[model samples]
Structure formats: C-alpha cells, structure tokens
Target: MFENATKQLRETVEAALPELNTVVGWRAGYDPLHMTPVFIKNAGDLSKLEWSPFCVQNLSGYLVKDPAVRAQDPSKKIGICVKGCDSRSLVALIQEKFIERNQIHVFGIPCRGTVDWRRVMKLGPLTGIQSARVEESRLVVEDANGGHTFALEDVLARKCLRCAHPNPVIHDVLIGEPVTPRVAVENSYGEVERMEEQSLEDRLGFWKKELDKCLRCYACRNACPLCVCQDRCIAETREPRWLTQRVGTSEKFLFHFIHALHLAGRCTECGECERACPMEIPVTLIKEKLNKITLELMSYEAGMDPEAVPPLLTFNPGETGL
Candidate 1:
C-alpha cells in the first residue's frame, strides 16, 4: 500500500509540477521511524516524496506559518500533500481566509493512522534502524540487532486511534483508497469524556501535574495550524503582559490554557501540538475539551466545511437550540 501510494503520489506530482510553485510532502527524517516535511520544486526531487505511517507531520501549517510560503508568487499554486487530519487543517485555513482554495493543489491521501515514535521507543529502544515498515497491523523494525515487531495499535498516535475522518475532507487529487474511520464523529471524544468523569478537583490536580512538566517552549503553539497570531502572540508580547517568563505551574497553566482558549472554535484537532511537544505532554487534550464543548453547544465541527462560518465567530441573537 505504501509503495503504490508513493508511486502514484510521485507520478501525480510530476504531472502537476509545471503548474505549481512548489510541492510540500514528506521524506524520511534522521531515522527510519521518523518523517519530516519536504518541499519539491522539480521532478528531480519527486523521488524524495514518501507516504507511510511514519509520515506524521501536518504540512498544512507551512502555508500560513512559513514566511517563504506566505510570500510566494500568488499566481502559481502551491501543491500540498495532506492526510485525513491534515486536510481538515487545510479546510480550516481556507475558512479563516489564511489561504484561498485556488492557491493550493491538494494531494489528499487517506490515512490508516500514523505511528507514534515515542510510543514505539517506549516499548523497546532501537538505534541505527535499517528499515521500518507496517505489515498486517504490526510494525516491523529492522536494525543491527535484527527485526522487532509491535502491534500497530500499541504504537499508533492516540489521536489516530480515535480518528473520525480517515479520508480527506477536501482534495484535488486522491492518493489512495479511502479508509473507514476508526470511530464515529459522535463518539470521537472518548478521551475527553473519560477526563470529564473525574471530579473538578481531580481534573485541576491532573492539569497542574501535567502543566508542571511544560518547558515553556511554545512548540505546541508554533505547531498549531490555527494559531495565526504569529508575532503579536500574547505569550511574546509584554505590552499586554498576558504571560510572564516565570517558570512555575501557574505560568505554564496560564500559557497552555490561553493557547487552548484561543483555538476554542478553530482547532482542527490534527494533534500537531501534542506530536511536536518534546516534553511529551498531552497538550492537545485541553483543546480537545474546548472542541467538544463547541460541538455540543453549536452543533458545529471545525474544519469540516470551509464555507460555513464558525459559530463563535459570528453572532445570531435569535439562534436557539443551545
């Protein structure tokens, strides 16, 4: 499946290169178990493009966050490869007017979850990996020591396990067969629901404990596709003084909570924030809770429809059903 999808992706991109300024995809990172975003400007670089469970970074953020991408020639469209979750981020960016539909050519690939390298390493440490591949719902890694196997479920990212949209929501080209979602949208909030069962005090204590582990790196903020505040971010601005450089649980709580709040009706739940966190904090959970509340209160899901305005972004005094 991986080989076929990658072959088709390369062929498709090769054909579209003439009409694009650049194509953003993935390539093997420093190791076999990791994948990093790659930018392809010509056919010669198409061989670098890869599609696999290890390709986990949400490349959509480059459209809005990268200065080079933001300043690129508008006449030539940029090509982007997106997974199920990443496609939603693209839609959200379109809805927010960060990027226009015509400005991008999306190569959407249906995803069957992605590997959590941290989870894989936790199960068993590996170094000098010669190769890694998914076979029959199991991950097989080959190294100098030989082959190691792990159940895919045991190493998949938590968000992927609960993915409700395994097929791209928007796409100009479909890369592979569509996949059945692991969970229905209505039941996708199991983690948040489980957290809600705990008492307020327990929840507070839980957040205090988790937040204390924060390194104040802003990796979560920077990784988020909807966090478009950029240079004017409250965390960096002393003009408003919303946050200080103090490194305490309170300070961490302030930064994370505010970050989540800012994405209340905007978060796409692509799990980039959690994935990017070097501290291994489940920072995405805070935004997941907000997304849940937004869904229930407004019966709206972020990034599902680019034409629809976010409920919180507009006012409707006569609107009922709350």
Candidate 2:
C-alpha cells in the first residue's frame, strides 16, 4: 500500500516544486528504522522524501514554530505532509488563525500508527538496524542478528492504541486511501478513565513518580507544534516566573501544569510530547485530562472542527452550566 503511494508522493512534490519554495517531509535518519523531518528546496532532493510507519513527527509545528515558514512570502505556498494526528493539529492551527489555510499545501496520508522505538528495542537492541517493514498486523524487522516479526499491537505507540482519527482531517491532496481506525473512538479514553478510577492519592502518587524522573529537557515543549511562545516561554522568564530553573518535584509538577493548562482546549493529542520525552513519560496524559474536561463541560474537541471556536477562547454568557 505504502509502496505505490510513496511513488505518487515523489511525483507530486516534483510537479509542485516550481510553485513552492520549500516542501517539508520526512527522510531516513542514521538508521533505516528511524526517520527525521527535512525541508526540501531543490527538485533533485524531492526523491529523498519518504513515507513509512517510522514517519512520526507532526510536521504541523513547522508551519507556526519555524520562522522560515512564517516569514516566507505569502505569494508562494509551502507544502507539508500530515498523517492522521498531524492533520488535526493543522486544523487546530487554522482554527486559532495561526496560519491561514491558503498558506500551505497539505499532503495527507492515512496512518495505521507509528512504532515506539523503545518498544522495538525491548525486542532487541537499536544497533545495526538493517530494515523494517509493516505487514498488516505485524512488523518485520531485520537487524545484525536476523529477521524477527513482532505483532503490531505490541510495539505501536500508546496514543495510537486509542486513535480516534486515522485519516487527515484537512488536506489539499491525499497520498493514500483513507484508512479505518484500528480502535474505535468510543473506548478511546479508556486510559484516562482507568486513571480516574484510581484513588485520588494514587493518582497524585502516579504523577509524582513519573514527573520525578523528568530531566527538565523541555523535549516535550520543543516537539510541540503549538508551543509558539517557546522563544519567550514563561517557564524560563524571571519577571513573572511561572516556573523556575530549580529542579524539584513541585517545580516539575508546576511545569507540567503550566504546559497542560496552556494547551487545555488546544491540544490535539498528537502525542508529540510523549514521543519526544527521553524519560519515556506519558506526557500526553496531562493534556488528555484537560481535553476531557473541555469535552465534558463545553462539548468541545480540539482540532476536530476548524470552524468551531474553542470553549475557553470565547466567552458565552448563554453558557448553561458554567
């Protein structure tokens, strides 16, 4: 499925090159099993673009966070690739008016899910990764030793286990056929529900234990496409310091709180924060809790509807139960 689509994508980008100054996509990193974000300016480099389960970065962040994309001449449009989760983020950006829809050419692809490298390492070491491929329900990995097939269910990212949207919500051109979600949305919030079922003290303990492992790397903040204030983030500011440089459990908790609160109704649950964390923390859970509140109190879901206003962003005197 991906084989044919990859060919089409290269052709499309080649054809669109004359009209675009840059095209953001993914390329193989140091290893065949790993992928990294790349920006292509020359047509000859279009062949470097690729599509695979390893293509996990939410490229939407570039649209707002990268000065180049923001400062580019409005007459020329930039092209970006989006998967199921990435597309929702693009819509959220559009809803927030961070970037106009006409400013980008979105290439959407239906995603099954992305693999968590850590999970894969649990199967074997990261060294000598020769190649990897996704077959229907399994992943075939070949390394220095030999080839091994692992059930996709065992190695997929946690967010993907409950993905509500497996197809792009917005796009100018779609790279592949729309895919059916691996899991239903009705039970998508099960992890959050399970956490809620825990005693309040247990919940507190859970976060405390997890956040204590934080290296204060800010990988989560950096990976977020929506965190536009990163350059002047309050976390690092002293005048009205919301968070300090000191490393402590209280500080870590506040840091996460600030991150969650800022993204409350805005987080599209792209799982970028969790994926980027070196500590392997479930950082997406923080945003999910806040997202659940907005869904319950205001009947809202971020990034699902570009035309709809966020409940917190607007004041509705007619709001019934506030």
Candidate 3:
C-alpha cells in the first residue's frame, strides 16, 4: 500500500512542480530504519522522496526554520507534504499567519501509523535492516541475516495509538485515499486519563523523575513544529535570563514548564518532541495534560478550525473554571 502511495505521491508532486518553487519531503536517511527531510527543486530529486512508516518527522516546521525556504520571493509558492497530525501543525501555523494559505501547497497523506525504532529493538537483536514493508497484519523486515516479521502493535508509536486525526484536515492535493482515524474524537484522552487519577504527589514525582533524565539538549523544543521562537526563546535569552546555563532537575522542570505553557492551545501533538529526545522521555504527556485542560475548560481542540482563534489566544469573559 505504501509503495503504491509513494509512486503516486512522486507523480503528483511532479505534476504540481510547475505551481511550486520548492517541495519539502522525506528521503531515506543514513540507516534503513530512518527517514530524513529533504528539499526538492527539480524532478531529478524526486527519487530522494519516499513514503513509509519510518517517515516520522513533521516537516511543517521547516517553512519557518529554513532560511532559504522563507527567503523565497513572495510570488513563488512552496509545497509541503503532511501526515494527519502534521496537517494540524500546518493548520496552526496558518491560523497564526506564520504562513499564508496562498503561499504554499499542501500534499496530505492519510497515515496509518508510524513505527517507533525503540519498539522495534525490543522485538529482538534486530539490526542491519536492508528494507522494511508493512503487510496486512505484520511488518516485514529484511536484513543482512534474513526476513523477519512482527506484529504492528509491538512497533507502533504511542501517539498513533491515540491519534484522533489520521486523515489530513487540510490539503491542496491529497496523495492517497483518505483513511479511517485510529482514534475516536471522543476517546482521545485515554493516555492521560489514567495519569489524572493519580495523587498530586505521584503526578509530581512522575515528572520529576522524567525531567531528571533530561540532558538539557533542547531536542524536544527544537523538534516541535509550533515552537517558532528560534533565537528569542526564553530558554537561552540573556537580557531576560529566563534560564541559566545550569543543568539540573529544577532547570529541567522549569524548562519543560515553559515549553508546555508556550504551546498551550497550539501544539498539534505530532509526537516529534518525544521522538527527538535522546533520553526517551515521555515529554508529550506534558502537552497531553495541557490539551486536556484546554478541552475541559474551554471546549477547544487545537488545529481543528484554521479560521477559529485558539482559545487561549482570545479572551472570553464568560468562560468559567478559571
């Protein structure tokens, strides 16, 4: 299914090239289990683009972070491909006017789910992967040794398990047939639901232990699609001195606090932050709790309506539960 979708994706992008200045997509990374972002300007580079469960990075952040992409002439339109969750980030960017709808083309793909490399490792001493493909009920892997198969449940990302939006919300050109969402809109908060039942101290201890493992690498912040504050970030600002160069549990906790608060009513829950963490911290849980708060207090879901303002971005005097 992915191979067919990949073929059609390349064809569609090639057909739309005349309308776009540059197209951003994923290419095979250094290893078989990886997929890295690439920019395509001509048809010759289309081979660099690939679609698979390993294509996990949310590419929308590139529009703001890549100087060359942003520096293009106003008349030249950019193109980007988005998975279901990634489209929400794009929608948030559009709602914030960080990027105009007319300035770019969107190729939306209905993601079944992305694979977690760590989960795959737990299956066995797996390495030297030459290729991988998803079968009807299992993932087939080819390596220097031989072919192996594993249940999809053993390797799927936790975010994909609870994904409420598997089909892209917005797309100028959709690459494949729309897929049914794995998660229902009403039951999207299951992960955090159990955590919420814990006592206050237990909740505090959970984060403290997690933050203690943080290397202060800022990988989580860097990977976030909506974290547009590149240089002016409070984490490194000098004049304000929001955070010192020190690395400690207190600093880590505070840093996460800032990160999660800034993303309130804005994060698309793409799971990039957690994936980027070298320490394997469940950082998205912080954002999940924040999302639940917004849902319960304001009845708002981020990135659902591009024209509707984020709840926190707008003031409502009648809103209670303050």
lDDT of each: 0.92, 0.88, 0.89
Over 156-210, each residue of candidate 2 has an lDDT whose tens digit, in order, gives 9999989989999988888878989876555678889999999999999999999
Q: For candidate 3, lDDT tens digit of each residue in 4-69?
A: 988999999999987788999999998777899999999999988898888999999999888999
Per TM-score, the best of the predicted structures is: 1
Score residue 280 of candidate 2 by CA lDDT.
Answer: 92
Model 1 agreement with the true structure over 79-109: per-residue lDDT tens digits: 9999999999999999989999999999999
Q: After superposition, how far is residue 200 of candidate 3 from its true place, in Å?
A: 1.1
Better of 1 and 3 by lDDT: 1
Q: Between prediction 2 and prediction 3, which has the larger TM-score?
A: 3
For all predicted structures, in order, the TM-scores are 0.98, 0.97, 0.97
Q: Which candidate leads in lDDT? A: 1
The backbone clash count of each candidate, in order, is 0, 0, 0
Task: Order candidates by TM-score, high to low.
Answer: 1, 3, 2
TM-score, structure 2 vs. true:
0.97
Misplaced by over 4 Å in model 3 are 320-322
lDDT over C-alpha atoms for residue 215 of model 2: 84
